[model samples]
Target: MTYTTEIIINKPRKEIIKTFEDSSLFPHWQRGLKRSRVISGKAGEEGSKRRLYINIEGQSIKMTETIIKKNLPEEWHGQYTSKGMKSIQKNYFEALDDHKTKWTSQSEFEFSGFMKLISKLLPDMFKKRSVMVQQDFKTFIEEGKPVKTN
Candidate 1:
């Protein structure tokens, strides 16, 4: 399944990038994300690994993400492996102006073996999952000003 989501933040490019790069900061804004841990290398650098545990379908799945590109204040790309499923995510953040940033995520993956058949039959399910995840981010960025996500 290919899933993607996007949002425009009202924060500066640097501030937004800081929030994205901070592994300990994910649970605060990332919806359904239980936690994130740095697996091996330093974050914001190529080859950094982050282990993410997320809730999906009332279940939890562990995902390991390897940084493919980590250009801060602009873009980040990574490949994720979760439960024998592999996918790649390209996250782009563009500064629309001094006070606005556009955040976009594009992911592509193939579900084979048995899952592929299900994905082919029910595309909306996967898309909805992606939408919910992004909506969490949107809520965090939009609401973090006055309150804490945690």
Candidate 2:
């Protein structure tokens, strides 16, 4: 499945890009994110891989993230692989003005095994989670307050 979601951050594109690129700030905005550790290459550069530990509901989910493309302040594309799911997220940032930026994400998910059933049964779950993260990021960058859902 594929969908697009966007959020307007009340910050300049440069600041938004810088903050988004900081892995240290991920847990603050990415709901349920517990921790991440780089396994290969440079942390944020293309071809780098990281293991992400996230607690969703009461389940501890683990996923591997591999950066596919990185164009600072404009685009960052990556693929996240989990047990039965592979998600490709392409993010774009546009400066609306000197003080505001628009962040858009084009996300696609491929599923197999049991996750295929889950995805078919609850497609909106993925989309909802994506939007939630975007909204949380907006709040984080604009107000410096990360809305922790867990």
TM-score of model number 1: 0.83
Residue pairs with colliding backbones in model 1 are none
For model 1, how does the per-residue alpha-carbon lDDT over 1-150 read when each residue is reduced to its tens digit?
A: 666787777878888787777767677766677877788888657998989898866879899989998777678899988764788889889889998888888988867666677677876876676666566666666676311443
Question: Which runs of model 2 end up more than 4 angstroms from their true locations?
Answer: none
Provide the global lDDT of candidate 2 against the true structure. Answer: 0.92
Candidate 1: list runs displaced more than 4 Å: 1-4, 145-150
- Per-residue lDDT tens digits for candidate 2, residues 1-150, read 999999888899999888889999998999889999999999899999999999987889999999999997899999999999999999999999999999999999999999999998998999999999999898888778877632
Instruction: For candidate 1, give the lDDT of residue 77.
Output: 91
Query: Could you report the Cα RMSD, in angstroms, for every candidate shown?
Result: 2.7, 1.3
Q: Which candidate gets the maximum TM-score versus the true structure? A: 2
Query: Number of clashing residue pairs in every model?
Result: 0, 0
My TM-score estimates for the predictions, one after another, are 0.83, 0.96
